[model samples]
Target: MEETRIRFGIMGCANIARKVSRAILLTPNTTISAIGSRSLEKAVVFASENHFPESTKVYGSYDAVLDDPDVDAVYVPLPTSLHVRWAVLAAEKKKHVLLEKPVALNVGELDTILAACDSNGVQFMDATMWMHHPRTVKMKQLLFDEQRFGQLKSVHSTLTFLAEEDFLKNDIRVNPNLDSLGALGDIGWYCIRAILWAHDYELPNIVTAFRDPEYHESGVILSCGASLNWKTNGKFATFYCSFLSNLCMDIIALGTKGNFRVHDFVIPFNEKVGSFYAVDNSKWAERALGCAPEPSELKIEINLPQEAFMVQEFGRLVAGVRSNEAKPENKWRVISRKTQLVIDAVVASIKNGFVPVEVVY
Candidate 1:
């Protein structure tokens, strides 16, 4: 039998890698070929615990996985600081790269990674699972309808989860030397991505960080909020991300004639089914006595989870490249760059005394 499935080598044993490993197995055209960690023993335990196939190789170093001839692609779940180094190495090895989000610490690093992928002719995609949810497509369709949604006016997104004491003190996200962007890089990435997706990836003209950003003693951001504005059309967006609040993921977009809301914009509350609410031409009746109609609840059901769908889409792209049928899909790369550019603007706004920062492309 010809081995047509894309074999993936995982470059880390982070907790999030477990979910992605399951996603790889669930995706039809993908398989977990290798698991790598600094400690070979840790890699072995991770593969066994994650129920990887017996043929999955365990390696002590990330470079070993990249050097493996059988690895057609690599999933990089490493820390933000390591993304550029390892992802670039993987691409240089001619392996497709599926990187986890907050793709990098800044746009400069992301561009470096993208350049490597382009030079090597390998697929590049950030692991933003929600982008693959069927519900997202449905919401986008509504947003594009001229009469149904009108012109986009404003968007507000929030994603916050209370971190445990131990995590607040020791998690990589709070470590300045590791995931230095902190909440903005971790949870805020999703919020930024959602806002961009709502706007069809249009780059905002200005970003202003909300005045009172919370920070850890280590100088890492613990919570923050920002407002984005489009000068040409006057469209605006606001997003808040924190590590000191109760779990919440919400995206509310208001248009001239309608509104749409998604309670779970990052990870759905239900793995198999996702939902959203939308309303068109909503109006009050009889001097604000009552509303004319309630928002419609739309549910999207899928055979596989969103992460698995992400893996499936990435695998298909890699397969296309392997068969010489198509080039690497650049859509995901473009989206990722735009998201990072907004994030960079937010960071600049925060650094420049909460002043508005102009987004440069």
Candidate 2:
């Protein structure tokens, strides 16, 4: 039997969109139906250079892509400031939305987008690719193990990369009007997401932003850190994100009796495999010369990159809804809202003299 194909319309030609377009093309049940840019020539060039199918449409206005009857879903890679407007419109158009993260500048905008999707009966998902990686699932299995791993203790995540000269000067991420959240939105989103994932999506009771976030002259955050505590259970998590440091992506999670370290949590350095170092329990060496029990390196092979896996999962949900086989999954909306709420809390803490802010939702 032939399978149904979910057609995707891309809403921008941003650099990240180029990578996602490839993922859509590689997805088994998804196809690129069209791509739009503010300028017609840019859209045409993007399509040609990316070797898109001849049937793919090119449009000068975003509305054209949303209005296309062939477009069953839209992958939006627009700036953070434009997310609510376009995402809501896409849902209203009956097109499922695969939005790029930060998802929105704040939780209020995210709720507006989610409400539109719910009212219109469309699936909503954020493009946080790491969530779909096989390695992520393997790590979670270990975290859930009661005997091998004890109760969650603490977590620390860091993601940083020095911006290029042009990126530092002209990237939309650092622009006050386009993406005011800046590095916190562009880079820290992953760190926050990792922390929440490690905590089983539990909202923290308090969020305290680390003092003195680096800021651009335009009043946008370039780097920031925050600490979170989950009630009185003593579960703690901290994260640091920046555009001013050497390239690195790390997640160190410690449990009462075990621990693991993910050196490349965002995007694996090796295209074929994602790996981590783990230890269940350890003891001091004889005479206390050094540490005992070497950590084991675990690797998981992947047939596709994390992004393509994300698209495949999103397509599965959209296809189910299109076929009347299932309702849209609300998990995506749930996590995105949680992540955005924490982001809002961080911004509030920074503004309020780095005081601990109680998270309400």
Candidate 3:
């Protein structure tokens, strides 16, 4: 009897790790191998609180997880500041790396991580859960339908969640020494990724940030917005992300012939199913009244949450590498790099007096 399931070691007990641990357990081809934190007691308690299997190892140091012979991959939910150091180390250890987004402090750091993964021949994927949703796939199809969507004209997205007073004061996302980019790194990452996804991972030619982004006094961004433009095609995308508003995840994409809309692009309101609305060209009503053609509501049902699907896909890549000696999927690495490039450009735009910064990558 052969065991083909991929074993995942998670580093850090960050709150998001709790959901990822569950996703690893729920994914059919993946299993929790070890849980590690800087504090041994924290690791042990995290393993128990998360109900990890009795056989799962609890290590006090991240290096211990990477050294464990049983660990085939590592899920890194560490702070953005630690991503390059640990992700590169995990790759150096010959372990596949599933990193949380924003994957690094900047594009340069992300490249170092990617280079390590490439040199080590291990898979590299950022934890962008929504990209794996079936609903997102269907929406991409609708957007490319010549008769329906035509050329992509513009995109607008927003991802914001109200933070409790305590969270605003103490959460890692707000701590400049930790999450650093703050709201721009935490939630804005998704908005930028969504816009890039709409553009088929194409890098925008220019990025101009909105003025006076709300900042935490510590200089970490609390709320921000940016506009990306493809000068050649005259198409553009705009997005806003914040930690000081009621929760909202919306995407509106208008095309030459139609429009596409999704209210819950990051995390769907319904766990069992997700949906979006789209419309094709519709004529004006006889009396210039309301149009008769309504946008169609399309829904996608899934057996697992988007995170579990992410684990499943990542594990599939690891297994292919381990069993068949197949090359790791480079598309995921490319997708991650493009996302980081835009993030860096946005930050540069903000820093350079809200001037448009040319995207070098």
Candidate 4:
């Protein structure tokens, strides 16, 4: 029964890690067994502040956490640039990896990480919390229902938040050396993932970055947008991400017979429940005075946070592998690779003067 309970080691004390650490604690089959940071004091402070289990070990170096024989998995919330290095090492050490989003700087780096995990026979999953949300499952069911939604037409998504002056100036996200992709890697990752999820992970044929991306003095992106085209059937999608706008996370998907929308797609406005709107066969009525069918508001209640659900699902897979009952799931790996591939294409398009860049694989 040892495999039934998966012990986790946290790789960094990033702000996002705080939320995920709570998730590990909340998940039934997972526990935070260790936490590591470059500074021992910082690690200690983080463990204490997050109220990690008293038995949780604190290490001054990330290597120490990976070296722990008791750690069945590692939750890596490091920056995009550091993902390949740490995640690969974690896999090579025979530890399952729950990596943070934008999984890597590009597809090439992600491939390296995936290869390591494959060679070591360990699980790999990105920490895209929304994918585990009940609301997302319901939405997917509706989108796939031909009778209700018909053919998909287009999607528009936006994710933005106003960062304080200090963050704009001092945050690592805007630091070229640390998080060069900036807002694109941070918030934009969610927007791109949402679009892909809506399209059922089909790779776009061409990606074009919107003209005039705003960059910090360090040459890190602060705001950007992109348009994606699926050549075969002419399905198109657009997404925008920024750190200069008021709080907004929205997705609008239109189909031939129905429309779907969610104002808070990245993170629910309230932690306990989330809502989305949908309309089927909506049409004008009474001389265009009103619509015949009104948009329906639906809400999903969550007993545990979405991040917790993500952890629990990851733990289930790890347990299955540990018990010799199943192999590591590559579905999540493929999804992560496709997302990174699109991100790479978008960056390439921006560098090539906004020309359309074909997305290969």
Candidate 5:
């Protein structure tokens, strides 16, 4: 039997859109049916380059794409500042949305978008590609397996990368309004998503945040870290995100009886998923499983690369979207809201010169 193909329209001609267009092409039950951009020339060029069917329509305005009854779903890769506005509009048009990260600048905006999706009965999500990766599932499993990382104690995480020089200026990262979200909001977000995933989407009871305003104008957070405590129990988590350093991404956790780590957090390849280190004692050992890393408490030097992580991960997200199985708990609105609340607390802490703010769930 032939499956129903989800007709997709792209809301921008951004480069990320090109990645998604390729993924859409790769997706089994999806099609890049239309594209809209501020400039028709750019839209036409992008659509043609991606080999979106010649019958696919190209429009100069986003509204035109939204108005296309044929577009059942929309992928919005717009700047962080515009996420809420367009997502709300798309939902009203009855088009499901796959929105990019930092879902919105604040919780208010995030709430508005979620509310709109609910009112309009459209599927909506923030594109935290990490959530879609198989490694994410594996990591969570290792955490709970009685044999590994039992009785988790503390978590430490870091995500940093050097942006390509040409991609720096006038980009969304540099725009003051859109730029209000820094490394934490931008990349550190993965850490929050990962942590929440490991904990079954439970919100931490206490959250304290800190931001480096000097590194960004518009009071954007440059380097933000949070110490989270779950009220129901005595579990604690700490996460760090930075933009002003060398390119390294990883997470390490210590449990009462074991330890676990993730070498490359962003986009780990299939082969790198289980590569990790573990110890029941205060000693070190390194071993590699050629096919896939062995399950252990401490996962380290997991050699997963960039495109391998995000591309296939996004493909899974698209698949979930097509199947109508995308959940609200995993929605970007929920993740971003938790993250923004963390950032808001961080900024308050930093403003008082690093005094900890009480994190409210």
Candidate 6:
């Protein structure tokens, strides 16, 4: 078989796309063939600044990009609500899709996109860049070991950020229609993903949650918490996330035998490494890794930019598609379903006054 270079056409000039576009540029095998935006002027400016070859098309509309027979795949960094809609349309156009996080507002919407991808024989993956991290897999290996956190007991995770003043002014994150799920959708999704990875817990049998209406002033949950109950064995875990709070990011999981913690789990900005700590025999003894010669004070510098990881990984995904190894065992559908399930329950719980909700599988 001939070596294939997955040609890409970016779907929007959104901020997220800026990161992804940079990533594509950094990676060697993937070629960005076109860029699209609602305005031709924006597309032209983006393409020109990025040094896209003259042959590369500057599309004024999404449909025009989709219509390009030369465009084999699309990177959609649109707003939260448009994820499912555009993903489905991209797949219908027979383009492989790498969509940003919170792939849909809910599971039902995710299902529709999944169906479209299946029908069109196109690969669709969620752009939860963190999920594809090398450290994530190693962390999962530790979590799955019975010797690690045997019989998970509880989970505590958080992610938050203060928006830059300039960004807060015009970003869609400030728009009610564009971001129905404020910080919860943006930051909370990672917390939920980490919890599941740590516990190896599938969909929770039951979930109950609450949103701070004060934080919900943006007409959405800026901060949210949820308690999850596992059906397989009645194992339970709790997760909390907020954008309204001061900067904080971490994931701590406690088990019957021991506890494991990850410092600054979400943002791997800079070359700062992330530390993973485990205490098995008891609370007194703690073993650390990822810092220096030894695991000392549960601190690891995760030195990487948010966009750097995603860019390289997207190249890998494109290669996988060409080689027919595109079927990743852990697809975004699982997390999307689990997250939407938890979010739906949380919404219900808040409306019903924090009453526990039994989630439908």
Per-model TM-score versus the true fold: 0.98, 0.98, 0.98, 0.98, 0.82, 0.85
lDDT of candidate 1 over 274-316, digit per residue (tens) = 9999889988898899996799889999899999989999999
The per-model lDDT (C-alpha) reads 0.94, 0.93, 0.93, 0.92, 0.69, 0.72
**Candidate 4 vs 5: which has more TM-score:** 4
- Residue range 174-197, candidate 3, lDDT tens digits: 988888999999999999999989
Model 4 C-alpha lDDT per residue in residues 124-153, reported as the tens digit of each score: 999999999889999999899887798888
lDDT digits (tens) for residues 19-76 of candidate 6: 7777666565667888889999999999888777677899899999989988878998
lDDT, model 6, position 279: 68
> Could you tell which candidate, 2 or 5, scores higher by TM-score?
2
lDDT of 6: 0.72
Number of the top candidate by lDDT?
1
The alpha-carbon deviation from the true structure for residue 131 of candidate 4, after best TM-score superposition, in angstroms, is: 0.8
* Stretches of candidate 3 exceeding 4 Å from the true structure: none
- Give the winner by TM-score: 3 or 5: 3
User: Model 1's lDDT to the true fold?
Assistant: 0.94
Clashing pairs in 1: none
Tell me, what's the RMSD of every candidate?
1.0, 1.0, 1.2, 1.1, 5.3, 4.4
Model 3 TM-score is: 0.98
Poorest stretch of ten by lDDT in candidate 2: 1-10
Clashing pairs in 6: 270-303, 270-304, 271-303, 272-301, 272-302, 272-303, 273-300, 273-301, 273-302, 288-295
